[model samples]
Target chain A: MVDEHADPTVGELSEGAILRSILDRLGASNALVGPGDDAAVIAAADGRVVATVDTLVHGPDFRLAWTSAYDLGYKAAAVNLADVAAMGATPTALLVALAMPDSTRLSFVTGIADGLRAACRELAPGCRVEGGDLTVSDTLTVAVTALGALAGRTPVLRSGARPGDVVAVAGELGRAARGLRVLFERFTDAAHLPVPVDESVLAPAERDDLAAQLRPAPPVALGPVACDEGATAMMDVSDGLLLDASRMAAASGVCIALETAALGDDPRSALTGGEDHALLATFPHDRPLPAGFRRIGRVRAQGPDPVLVDGARYEGRAGWDPYRDWDARTG
Target chain B: MVDEHADPTVGELSEGAILRSILDRLGASNALVGPGDDAAVIAAADGRVVATVDTLVHGPDFRLAWTSAYDLGYKAAAVNLADVAAMGATPTALLVALAMPDSTRLSFVTGIADGLRAACRELAPGCRVEGGDLTVSDTLTVAVTALGALAGRTPVLRSGARPGDVVAVAGELGRAARGLRVLFERFTDAAHLPVPVDESVLAPAERDDLAAQLRPAPPVALGPVACDEGATAMMDVSDGLLLDASRMAAASGVCIALETAALGDDPRSALTGGEDHALLATFPHDRPLPAGFRRIGRVRAQGPDPVLVDGARYEGRAGWDPYRDWDARTG
Candidate 1:
C-alpha cells in the first residue's frame, strides 16, 4: 500500500535519482545545513552536543516478512531519539546510513524516509536528517546517529543516584515484550513462515500491546522536563527494568529497592521486559516527581546486590539479550 | 595470530564482555562524556558541529579475502574523516556501529578497534571513538558517523565555486583505481579466491600503490589549510575526478574545465578512477593555491556540460559505481 508509485528496484534506478526522491520526501529541516551537502551543519548550542548511535540489521533485528519498511524506519528513529532523550537533551538532528541489496525495491527506501519524517514530527519536532551514505550490501541494514543540544544544562548521568532518592519511570513497560511473545507464537504456529494474523480476534489491549512491540512510541518529551525537575540520574529501559536498574546501581554505588505493588503486581513482567524504551530516573525524595512519572522504587545505600524487591534480593534473568545463544531461526 | 591471548569466536563471547574488551583497548578519549554513558558528549566549539555518516558492506565494498579486518576498519575511518575534512572542519569524534555474524572471531573485532585508533592517531589527533554499538547480524558491516568542529570558520561547500576560480587537488589520483585494477587481476588469477599475492614480483611503487588501495592515507592535513587560504569551494575525490567535478559544477552552476596534461597521460584513469579520498578545491584565480596543491583545471561559466576535458566534452563512464551490475561475484 505504501508503494503506489512506479515501484522500481534500486538496481533499475540511478543512485542520484533515488537520493533526489528521498530528499524530496524528507521535507524541510531546522538544521543550519541539511542533507544535500558533503556534511551537514547543525547548531550545537551551548558549545556541546549529545550524540548516540543505534543499528538495526535485517535478519537479526527485523524480519522483512514480519514488519513493514515503514515500521523499521520508525522504530530505528524512536530508538535513537530515546537515547538522546535519556541524556537529558533536546534531540535536534540525525545522520542515517543505509545499506541494502541491489534487488531491494525503491519503494521500501522511500517508505523508510516517510517513517523517519513521521517520527520526527511526532516526537522531536525540528529534528532533521542531516547527511548520510547509501551503499550496496548483501542484506538490509539501517544505522542512525542522533544529535541533541543540552542548552547549557548539566547532563543527568547514570552515576548520580543517592540514598533516599525516589526511583521513577516516564513511560510504559512489558507491553513490547508481551507483544513480541504473541508475534512469536503466531509465527511459530504458522510453520516458520509469515502468515497474516487475525488481529480482529484479539482484544483491544492486545492489539495496542502488539503495536507497541512493533513500533514503540517513547516519551521523548519527558527527558528535558525530568532534567529541569532536577533528576539525579536517568537512562532508557532498552534492556528492561531490572538490568538497567542494576547498571544504574553499579554506576552510582547504590542499591535500588522496587515495590511490587507500585508496579501493578505484575512484577516479573514489569521488571524483565525489554524494548519498552521508557525513561527511568531517580529524583531527590523531597522534590516532587514530574507529571506522568510514576514512583516505583527508592535508591538505597550500597547493599549485597544492586537491586532488591521489598528489601530482599531477587535473582532472575534480567532481560532479553541478543547474543546469548538464543534460537537464531526464530529470533 | 592476532588473538594470541584468548582465541574465541564472537559466539563464545557476551556482548558485555566484548564491549569491555573494546573499551579497554580504546584507552583514552577526548570526549567530555566518554563511552561509559548512554550517549557521549562532545564539545561543539563555535556553537556548531559538522556531521556525516558512511556505511561499508562486506561483499560490495570489500572482499574479506583481499583485505584484513585492520585494513577494513582503517579504510572506513579514513573515508568518513575525509568527508568531515571536505567540509573544511577539524574532525573531532566518531561513533561506530558494527554488525557481524556470530561466526566472526573476537580478534577481528579487536583488530578493527586497533585500526580505528591508528587512523585517529595518524590523521586527526585528539579525535576519539566516543562510543559504539555492537550487535549480531548475518553479515559483517561497519557504519561510522563522524563529527567535526568548524572552530569559527565558515564551511566550504561544493556549491561555492565561481567562474573565475582555479581548480586544484592536494592528493593523488589514478593510484587507488589502478591499485584496484591490479588487485582484481591478482584476485582473478588466484581463481576467485583470497590467495595471497606475491608483491615482490611488482615494482616498489606498484606495491605502494596497491597498499594505497587497501589502506588509503588521505591528506587530511591539507583540508584546513585550503580553508585558511580562502577556498571558494571544496569536496573529496571519492567517486573519481571527472564525476565529482561534474557534481561540484552542477551544484555551483558552473563548468569545470580539466587540463588533461596536468594529470598523467592516462587521462581516463585520472578522470574516472574512484575512491582516491583526495581533497579537491577551487580558489580565486588571483589567489595562490595552497602549498602541496597542484593546479589541475579552472572553473568556467555555466556551459552545456558540467565538465570538459581541455575545453572539449569527453563522453565516458565517470567512475566506479557500486550499484552497477559489474562482476557479480568478484565485486
Candidate 2:
C-alpha cells in the first residue's frame, strides 16, 4: 500500500522531486527515455512515425463535476490514438502535459494514469506512457501527444479522391452523438438510473448510443487495411459525415455525391452527428470494397461543392460548432 | 499588407472562423495538415523523431504585466525548441494549444503567431506551425509540442560516464540566473547588483554575466557533435551544473570531480546558475575535444558524492526549486 502522506500537493514538491517519485514507481519496460530528460525517445521500428495531439480545457471542453480525472485521461489518449489510426499508424508512445491547481490529490493523478494505460492497452498494444510535464495552475487542463509507426505502408491522405471513386466507411457511427445527447439533454433521467437497468427505460439504441459517445471505439486497423487495399482520399469522420466529406471534396478538387438514402436506418443521425471516429475513404470504382466496410457514396466530375441525396446541395448546418450556439437543423 | 481593424475579441469569432482567418494569413507553408482535421500530420525525415512538450499557465509561469502575448509565444517556442536541440535533433515542427478568455483580441493572437514564427526561424529554420486547438477559459494558458529529427546519429545519454572521462561544456551559464536576480532584486549598489552594467558603473565581468542570463544562447550543434565524437554521457545544463552533474553521477553510478578553479571566472556562478542550455558531455581523455567546447572537470572513482573544488561536496544552493521559498533565501 502507498503511504497517505506521500500525496503532497504539487506546489509542495519540486518538479524534479515529483518526477523522481513517479519514475521510481513506474519500473522499466516500455520506457526508452524516461522523465528528467529533455524528451523521451521511444522505439520506432518502422521507418515512418505517426503523430497526433489534443488539448482539453476546463469548463469549455469538460466539467470537473461531471468527469473524473481518470475519465479525462482516457478520453484524451483515446482521441489522439484514434488520429494515429486514421493515418494508418500503430501507436507506440505518448507524451502528456498537465496543468492543475496545487491542491489536486495524488490519487487523482494516479487514477488518470490508470485510465491512460487502460486505453493504451485497448487501442494500441505496445504503446507506453513515456514522459510528461506537470505544473500548478488555476484550472485543470490536459494535453496529449501520441506517436506511432506506419509499418511500411504509404500514408492515407485526404487529397487523392478522383472521379469514378467510391466512398466507404468502417466502424459504427452516431453512437457517440447519441450518447452526448442523452448525457447533456437527459441528465436527470439518467441520474436515478442503476447499472444494467431495464432496456425499455432508455431504449436499447439510446443506451448503446450514449455508451458509444462516452467511450468511442475507433477502428484502429481499418486505416492501414484501407490503404493497403488502395484507398484514395481518406479521413476520419470526426465532425459529422457531411462536413468531413465536404473537406475531402475541397481538398481533392472534386465533387462528392453522398447517397443519404442508402445510409440505412438513422441516416440523418450519422450524417450530422459527430465523434464517430469511423474511417471514411474513397477507392477507384474498379477496386472491390474491403471487408467490413460499407459503400455509402461516390466521387463525381462536378467541381468542388459536395452534394447529398441525389445531387442536391446540403444546405443544413453540417455539424456541431463549439463556438456557436447549437440548434438542431436538417435539410 | 494585412487588414488593420479594431481587433475583434476572440469571443466575437467562432472557433472555426478564427482558425480560417489565421490559416488564410499564414498561407500554405505553415501547414502539412491544418486545423479541422482529426490530427495534423507533419513531415519528419531522417527516420527518427524527437519530441518535447511544455505548458505555461497565467499566474505561476508568467504575469501579463511583464509579458505580452507575443513574448509568451516566443518564450514558449524557445523552451520547447531548446529541448529538441538538447536531444541532438533538428526541430522541424510545432503544435500549439491555447486557452484564453473569450475577450482576447484577435490582434494579440496574430502577434502571438508572429512571435512563434520569428523564434522558429531563429532556432530552427523552416520549422512549420502545423496544427493546434483554441478554446475559451478563465485564465490564459499555452501548451506547445516541438518535433525534431536526429539525422541518423546516436542520441547522447546520461549513463555512459566512466572514471577516466573528461567533462566538458559548450555555451555560457549563469546568465538566466542573474537575469532573474535583476528582475526580482532592486539592489542599488554596483557591487551588490546580480548583473554587471556599464563599465563606468561596475566591473566588466558582471555586465557580461548578467547579459548571459537575459538571452540564453543554447549550443544546438554541440549535442550532435558530441554524440558523433563518442561522448560517454551527456545532458543539457537546465539546472545548475552542480545539481545536474550530481544527477549524471547518480545515473552512471560514479562520482564526478569538478575543478571549479578551471571554470572560467566566477566559478560559483557556473556551478549553481541555471538555464544555460549548454551541452555537457564526457569523453575519453585521449579523444580530441570538439570545437566551441571547454574542459571543465573529470569523472572520478574516489568520491561518494559529486565533489567540487578541494574535493568537497557542493553546499551552496545550485539550482531553482519551484516549491522552495525563493524570497526567504535570496532576500
Model 1 lDDT tens row, A1-331 = 6463578878777778889888888988688878877899999979999999999888767777667888888888999999999989989998889898888898899999988878888989988787788888887899999999999889989999999999999888888888877777765454675555568877898788778877889999899999999999999998889988999999999999988888874678789988889999999999899997999999999989999988888877888676774456765
Proportion of native contacts kept per candidate: 0.78, 0.50
- Where does model 2 sit among the CAPRI classes? acceptable
Stretches of candidate 1 exceeding 4 Å from the true structure: A1-5, B1-5, B189-191, B325-327
Model 1, range B184-239, lDDT digits (tens) per residue? Answer: 77655545655555787778877877888888888887888899999999999998
lDDT of 2 by residue, A41-144 (tens): 66555644666777777666665544666677777787778778777677778888888776666667766777677778787778767888786677788888
In lDDT terms, how accurate is model 2?
0.72
The model with the greatest TM-score is: 1
Steric clash pairs (candidate 1): none
Worst 10 residues of 1 chain A by lDDT: A187-196
Chain A vs native chain A, TM-score per candidate = 0.95, 0.85
lDDT score, residue A70, model 2? 66
